[model samples]
Target: MQSMEGSNRTLVVTEFIFLGFSGVHRGQSFLFLLFLAIYLFTLVGNGVIFTLIQLDSRLHSPMYFFLSHLAFIDICYSSVTIPKILVNFLRQRHTISYNQCIAQMFFLMIFSATQCALLAAMAYDRYAAICQPLRYAHLMSRSVCVSLATASWTCGLLASTIHTVLSTNLAFCGANRIHHIFCDAPPLLQIACSDTYVNEMALHVASVFVSLGTFLLVVVSYIFILSAILRIRSNTGRHKAFSTCAAHLVVVIIYFGMANVNYNRPSAGYSLEVDTLISTLYCIIIPMLNPLIYSLRNKEVKEALRKVLGGLKKDSGLPQ
Candidate 1:
């Protein structure tokens, strides 16, 4: 699709073509099946986690509260890109409307930014629980938890709004082919015919403020948490305290690591295949790993899962 600019008579793009899969001429079916399975797993995994947190009284706490938001974000984040990719695989022409691409980028930024804030919130929750047990209740009271969650979403909404509004104003009068797997800010900016100085600056500022800022918060929270853990004289106490934070730390490392690579890397000397792989890992695989990481590492979550499953079985009149 194309649109005419009034004075210059320039052809404006009404749709975008995805070139992420352009090099692949075969095994499209296999790729589709793999992504389909991953998407389904991401939904079920995050869904079960979200449901279990809501249903199980044992799982109700500030930590779990933040976790539920994370799970939901993961669901929304993967949904923004994966389904479109799936559909594109089935069609000969891999394309998305310009408006859809903008919307996709908007939601994608929202969820990713939200998850970063949520993870930092979770880290602070852990710090409160471990470093100040006596004050943990007051620190993470229901109201406080709600406020933190709300703030995280607000952060995402504000950041996404800035990027999306800026993105829509750019002129896509030349190539509309997005080089990356999805309609991300970087890929979209690369295709804009107009000067992207402001957009590029915004992206850089956001990378620092949103990504680096939240990451530093997590780091600072963990520093205090680790200090308190080390001061514990009892081996079991130290071990137990550390264990509470292990899964979150792992997730933070994986998330920030991939994000730094995906967004912060030098724009030069990167191949499309490399970019696609990193994006797939960052956007696609990370969400699926979150619930699994929590489930496998967390005894409470696993026990809750077992109980929930057992209850379902008992309700169905199956063997205990």
Candidate 2:
């Protein structure tokens, strides 16, 4: 809640206090442990997936290429917020400096938007594999994958730059309290004393192009994939084709569904507690689940994980 007097005779906020944990009079330690455990699991799970993809030659295809990037993004996305949250859980005041808040918001948006685009790229990879197996090699060459990954990151950077730049222009005055868990655009907008019409419009536009737009891309790719799968005369062929997409489809549904709930909800009628819960699910829980979903659903990832574990066990002279 620190503020400085500006030349315009207005108080400028120097920091923000988070009210996310204000209601908890007890169980701080329990919450800390829970969040820490989930953060560690997210790190390890996604780290393992990335490492396995790098080590396993069988997993060097376009699908796994995109998956490795996804895993990397998950690790980064979770790290951007969870570490600060864990630190705040132990402190009496959940406070963040204004600069830190901006940084957090920037990185958070970058990773989130990148993941959305990356997921769409992965869907296209699946579509190419299933719908046009013969041309899959050319459609998903190494250069193509690199370009897609680069484009995803570029989109994220551009979108984040727009939002972050717009956000910096907002005058916080003396209102330095953030209602939500993290330094997202919406929460910051809610607390800004200045006009936020431009910010809100930017957010809505980014939502359409980055969130909803990527979601529609995924949906369209799946439609073509489904039609392609249906064309296969053999039942087993259809099942195999569908199985390849099942994991990514589930991930797309969960990510976009939670995103819509977290972002697209009406600003009224929802309590702060509900907002906090949805943010936790969308930001904290989803990253941890992504790797688990992929590992559990994909036989190749599981096999690669087993091989790595076995190699480690053998190197340590442990029982097979």
Quantify all predictions' global Cα lDDT against the true fold: 0.92, 0.92
Q: How far is candidate 2 from the true structure (C-alpha RMSD, Å)?
A: 1.3
For residue 10, model 1's alpha carbon misses the true position, in angstroms, by 0.6
Task: Write candidate 2's Cα lDDT for 3-89 as tens digits.
Answer: 455566677788889888789869889999999999999999999999999999999999999999999999999999999999999
Lowest summed lDDT across 10 adjacent residues in model 2 is found at 1-10
Off by over 4 Å in 2: 1-8
Model 1, 256-313: lDDT tens per residue? 9999998887856278899899999999999999989999989999999999999999
In model 2, residue pairs whose N, Cα or C atoms come closer than 3 Å (at least 3 residues apart or on different chains), thus clashing, are none
Off by over 4 Å in 1: 3-6
RMSD, each candidate, Å? 1.1, 1.3
**lDDT, model 1, position 243:** 93
